[model samples]
Target chain A: MPTRIFGDIPGIPEGSEFESRVMLSHYGVHRPLQAGISGSQLEGADSIVLSGGYEDDEDLGDEIIYTGHGGRSLDTGQQVTDQQLARQNLALALNCQRGLPVRVIRGYNHRSPFSPTEGYRYDGLYRIDSYWRERGRSGFYVWRFRLVKLVTVGAPNQVDEERQTYGETRRVDVTIQRIVRNTEIALHVKELYEYQCQVCRTLVFTSAGPYAEAAHIQPLGRPHNGPDTLTNLLCLCPNHHVMFDFGGFGIANDMGLIGLDGQLHQKANHRIDRQFLAYHREHFLMNP
Target chain B: MPTRIFGDIPGIPEGSEFESRVMLSHYGVHRPLQAGISGSQLEGADSIVLSGGYEDDEDLGDEIIYTGHGGRSLDTGQQVTDQQLARQNLALALNCQRGLPVRVIRGYNHRSPFSPTEGYRYDGLYRIDSYWRERGRSGFYVWRFRLVKLVTVGAPNQVDEERQTYGETRRVDVTIQRIVRNTEIALHVKELYEYQCQVCRTLVFTSAGPYAEAAHIQPLGRPHNGPDTLTNLLCLCPNHHVMFDFGGFGIANDMGLIGLDGQLHQKANHRIDRQFLAYHREHFLMNP
Candidate 1:
């Protein structure tokens, strides 16, 4: 007795019997491809054989069997004969479960008629009839298959691992840079001038930004020994930075503020006025 | 003869006369609070004064002297006396100078004032004439004078140095706390799970904040070994944190996800999926 199978029905385990019921609900849905043995050609022969797989019928075979290149006499094996060719044709049709519109195309560079020449095209296509027939002669049968399912999931299929690794590594690198910058600036300021301002008592941040500007006591443009050195730099606010830059002020021999015109007086009256000087005298670096 | 003594200003050693002029101009325009002198009494004194070794003025003894205690008497100190005070008062009236309001209440804090009692009623005021008359015959007088001037302008009296210092110190402390918190959290995450996630290949951040969150693999309220061990903690984002907290999704013995129904599936299909498991398989620590 030949077993029966439904090509459209999913091959689920016995425990998942509900799957067949669900699939049957969509049975009327048209499928262009069909796979099964054909019964018409092999009439009135002793033990008539159907090469293709069985499908809801006992007289047909469960799979197709390839009889090789046809259109030749089987008894003589010399010339292509009509009867031998007919048998081969029957075998191909039964094995492939013919009567389906699905077609298989193959080539190294095949272009679809509807697609652009530069775009991708189907390189090979094998109808269900031919596929089953080819597999039957190779001693293979009952190939299990499942429908392709789509899902909108996080992370793309390609390069997801690489992206994740790169993101993680980049995050760590950024964090380390912040820490190193903070510590390096602090240590540099501490080492130079012993962490003290020459004209103000502010000693909070040593970073190179708005709060603390690494000032050049001697002009950067001027020829000096260590313009970039911490010793030549004084951390100052914008106002004092301008004053010092324009020679409106200077540190006295005793490290006091000497006003413009070479006066040690708080005459210019900039932000670093006398009161600030007093603070500096009490707190700034004594030898800077 | 009036004598003159000139000393270079504290910071301006060259005596920068222009600086003195600038200081005078600043005092005239900005009107900084007078230091080291009572303002209301001496309206005509220069920015600086010369002390003649405690000797009294001898130029105008005949003028009247007003005492702080609501009394008036003849000037008896040598050639100069109340006449100088009268001249200064006349100069104030003539718009050459202005006198500050006399603070009659002594030791009465301006910020927090105390009610006056009988004993301290005239605390800040006293009579110089009566003080002298009470001690001797008539009144003694001597003669000596000199000239000096202000050289530097300082901050207004409103600038509270102590309060500013306190504020700066507070800001520094807060910054340090933030830095320390960031470092501690980062280090904690690095140590836990040995710097890898059991479900994803994300690395711990060196800085704090949104980089990492502590996760309990089993759960907090469970009776298992959820007592804050490095093994129990898995650093994750807010999304992953919530998913692992409420959803019954967990890593199986092979580090693959075991869904809520205890089904061990390498392929994730549910909402709380284990898509990040592939990276973790290669990077994360596996016990078995």
Candidate 2:
């Protein structure tokens, strides 16, 4: 069956876009009213009545009205019923405590409560859960209604814009720090070795980030050149650095690298030795 | 004591730069010349000799002069010396080929060769392995040489202008094919689905090559509309692709992915599901 109902609610300011599809639930102090024909009887009904009225207003001014799902009413400043006020309170509480915005709406209507065991039935008043907000020049506004009984104490707010902003800023700061550190190390090593490894002739662009790693050729604890000095350092990849540290290889005085096993280790076969040599030859401290 | 001798040898044409020191053994033709210094008391003393004679009749008529270390002269037309020539002939006959271009000028000039008993030694002469033709007003040349005899080959040549032009042409052909294939699929699906795997978005760039794998959402055997569409395709790392193929996890219709077992059967505690979800949310794929 087709149902007609006021799409836009009154009293609540408009301009809030609908964020997500509304969820239907039972009515309570904190729960918004749900309205939908039972699945089995939906084909039988020809038309449905949607009711809207101010529970606080005893006069007949509070009355049910029928309009298409997407239709809007002329009344704009009608007072919000007690049910609508309850939903607004729930949304406010959720927003204040938690950081997620509520995405439910209360339409202008009331209907008989549905029971799971019942096959199919409808009361005179039709309860509607679907609602829309007014779209302004800039943004849209959302409207919600809650029954007072469903409202709980100290419920977390769904949205905290300020806290979210701070968290985003923190994440950005951390990323920037990582990039800066990586760049600084890469550049310093490349500059120290003049863009090539002393042991190997590996060349890199800009000598910073991803391409090189700053390494202490001699152990830092030894009484020798400063750790940061270009002479005491060599730019190498992780594998080469590990091999060099274990004394598995050494650079000869003549600038050629000597592997532990006395064999010619070409770059194709011995990656660690080749990478270290490339870095040393391309970017290393040369005697003045 | 440092002894110096100077003179010019014929046939070495002028304008060719020569190193001050050379290894006598590098001379493919003149092995006996080096023998003169070995076992001789003068081995410990630095000696220099000069070879001077030039046939003014030839275009390359400059006398090649050598100083530092002991030296000997040979006729330009003569094929080295008898002893070295014999060894060269034997090697050529055994290998069934002509000998390479080798030259000898001086001996015992720099560091002493280690492992005197071993036939192999660090000869100072650098060998030219290969060459390629280039383009333009003056074609560029690439030479690979090493400081030590063992280090025979240096770094590979970079992609020069000629190679780059060829590469661009090849790239254009491949790109056109890719564009045609992509156009056949919905453009939005390609944009919506990330090029990386929905799981462990591992993007590893290594010296060997770049790695990435494209995958299909629905198995190829399945029948459906847009089954092989771009929206159903994903580019994933190798590890993640294997996991998906084995049905370790699946993405729900609501875009939420669910995992079967706690972890992959053979793989360790690599929570593939969580990894995929994390990247999906962090990279805004879920919202996108």
Candidate 3:
């Protein structure tokens, strides 16, 4: 009855009840129930739940939100109502209209320490975009949904049905030419840093207002053809444009800031060209 | 007659005449006409042609390739004929039905060397999925078409009409949970590396045949909780999985082959747990 086992196990000969699974098998799916503390609760679980909590996943930045689930009560902290079963899988992830597939079960959230050590994982495919019925951070009565993430984007000669159902063999279609930047020179260098963040000055408001990120410093397509000028841009703010595209830091030539810590202040009036800060310290900080 | 200019441009005392443009101003565009050495003719000009030549540049790619311009017959070596605006932009890029957008102008053929430094710089939209006529390499007959990159996919409460006409603001909406594997343990470790590439053994084939890439060597999410077993996988081939996930190399604790140079060679039948290659040489080669 060898149900499924593979590779090196030299010592399992002693007990032999045939229990070598390792991971990925959560069998029949469907688990959602928790409550309290939701939006962005990483270590304590919930993972994500926006909108119905009245928006605040960084104010729904990056769009799509309207997410909610469960009416937890675990005995007297009562508020569990709206017809459960994870609200019928949020009405079957909102009528599966070409999207529905998610996972992350973990011992049904006991205020989450993710102890699922085994039994639920897949985590992809989502698409419900909208649902309603809220009011329950214990005050009981929840059920929001808006989902998103079904991400299928393939048609360039199509062939990515989940990487061909995960058998994913070398695909290669290649043809990436590039050269873009002329939205009036990226909105005149993000209004000359007025949108903020010339190095953690952090601004980011939003609702259609302040929000930075222009960054470029020696990066404008294939093998650094860097030249979109304003001395190769950089207003930043998406966490310092992913920490200056992950070189973690750089900027000196007396303009100071060599690997983070500060003092490259000019605040604005345009004058950055120290040969593009020595080409971002010779291609991303002395070659990262 | 002020024509689109933005922000700070002080000073010009030494240049009494005035000329500070910096880029972008190709007015009333529509200039595609050339010939000669076409395909693969990189640095001699022709920037791109793959068949019928005409005139249409609808701000480059994302859904539009009904392109066709003029043919060049530069002093003798001739074949330029198929007229009528390249047969009505190849019957509107083979009948719109849901496609179009392209760009690659460079001194209109005549043996390439990409010199479209300006007067054309959007280049990023294509979709002609298929077209035919063949006979070229100059003996002229050309009409090919095949182009692909159209990519659109949005719809979860929409908003990505080409990144809102390219004004792309950091849109996040993420919910990407992972952990999918177990297609019978990735097909028994690609039949125990029989699919090839234990460090450049290569084996790629295609048309639905041989193709490797199992990789893993301790890497299963969250600070590498790694454990999908089969001695922690590795079949490789996407250029050695980007050189073994960019630490450029690993696998020595006497199983040999540390920073690249071959031989852990077992060929099959299991047994490779040198403590998961010493946890890929202590978490990605001595902490990278």
Candidate 4:
């Protein structure tokens, strides 16, 4: 079933037209209403589609890479001495003492170049996990919000009798499960490499930050039986990870990266374990 | 640069609303336009967005798995006696001698469940390379079109000077080239497996037919030096191919399929080359 969100703006159909909610700056106790501002705090709303702190053309992410407030206001684009209320909202969102029920609506942004037809889609519920002041790409101090999606709490897996009677159980109730990875080790390896691909030394910049994935050299789990450790991890960009996983390349016994293209890739770091590399070679590389 | 499309629908704002172009189907001389039908030859159009013949809810592919022209027309839901113009258009699309200017758009169906914002996106210019009559998911005769995107003719290593002057070249002119795969070998392997995953013996049914992908056991290219031959190929479903690529499992020396889940998978057939398997084991699989 699809997720649901509720809130309507006058003069526009709910799921069309607008890609963002009314600016959060327009909310609070004494905001104007005629200009589409909510005069008072509209708490307990199901969802709010935030546009984020990207300048005129910036992308948003699961974790908001917020620009700091108080230097120059985005609305006015003028220098300011006092802290901005937008910054305060970030702090308020982070406050666990008064758990604010701010449900963020997720969807494709129209401001981006390749905007999709999915207007303002409601991804899921989320909460502010962390926030901090940081320097943005614009060289301005911005407040960042690290938001995490709230997973749905479901009842125990009890097959519905009606569904079973129609043979829907085989079709609809099929479940595919995967192992819960050790995010700590993964994150550590990525941080160690500073979000650059180990094989190609490439870093991809996203709306959130430089994005990189941790590849388990020897995959962790039952048949592979590889350990989830920092030594067994390689920080790589998404493309290289896919190539590595697909047997597009491998590492020699001397730690030399062997790719199909014949290009010799130097290892940027030496923390990789030879034992784990050997294990990967024996099974995945296909030549022993 | 982004691909462009043309046409206007009544209420939908141009370039915003609606998922398809109204021209391709409407332009054929004597073609019926009233109920979204064309009576005769549709020519002189640059592009088309065709939503195929799936009952109520079905997905279409670049290779159109078109149900044959008669019996229960999609337009009326009643039995069709003569050739469907929609089917005829597909045939015309496949005619290279005619070479009608037809570019197929690729995107999600607005009517299908979980459709994304990118509905009917203009992917690229394409020409119908092949066509055949096939049995569809609804047990109807369907016409299928195999379309291939036309590559642009460009001079080697020449960067646009205007883009280069502003550093826009770095941002926009970056092109990542991939090795042109040997489709003949890949297709042969897929056909050998009868479009079923060799590891699981599972066939994924699409509106067109069963779909499978070919994997290179020992990757071909400079680093891995695996060949593009039957000895190095494995037919697999998309999911299992990803698993195999990621070193999630391997074929033991004795032809045993070893996976992380420890599931005992038997090889449906036995054409695997022990030499290629040994190479894959040494380099790609990690350990013995």
Q: Which portions of model 3 show Cα errors greater than 4 Å?
A: A1-66, A69-72, A75-145, A150-196, A199-202, A205-216, A225-235, A238-252, A256-276, A280-288, B1-148, B152-288
Better of 1 and 2 by TM-score: 2
Give lDDT tens digits, candidate 3, residues B1-288: 332111111221111221111121122111233321122111111123322233222222222222333343657535565322133333333222122233232222212232242233323223344332333445444443434443333434333222112113212111100111232354467767777777657564321234455667766532235676787877765445534543346767555676656666666476677777776555334222
The best candidate by lDDT is 4
lDDT of 1 by residue, A1-288 (tens): 232221212332111211221232233211212222122232100011112222211211111122333332457533233122133233333322221111111111222232223311221111222211112223322221110111112222111111112212223223223323333443354334343444554332211111333454443210111233444445553334434542335565444565523332221221222333332222222222
Give TM-scores of chain A for all candidates.
0.22, 0.24, 0.31, 0.42
Q: What are the Cα lDDT values of the candidates?
A: 0.26, 0.27, 0.39, 0.42
After the best TM-score superposition of candidate 4, give how far the Cα of residue B181 lies from its true spot, in angstroms.
8.1
| Per-residue C-alpha lDDT of model 4 across residues A164-251, encoded as one tens digit per residue | 0111221211210011124446656777888777776766542123456778877653234567677788887665665455344677
**DockQ of candidate 1?**
0.01
Candidates 3 and 4 compared by lDDT, better number: 4
Off by over 4 Å in 1: A1-288, B1-187, B192-196, B203-210, B221-225, B260-288
TM-score pick, better of 1 and 4: 4
lDDT of 2: 0.27
Candidate 1 docking class: incorrect
Q: Score the docking of each candidate (DockQ).
A: 0.01, 0.01, 0.02, 0.02
Off by over 4 Å in 4: A1-288, B1-148, B155-181, B261-270
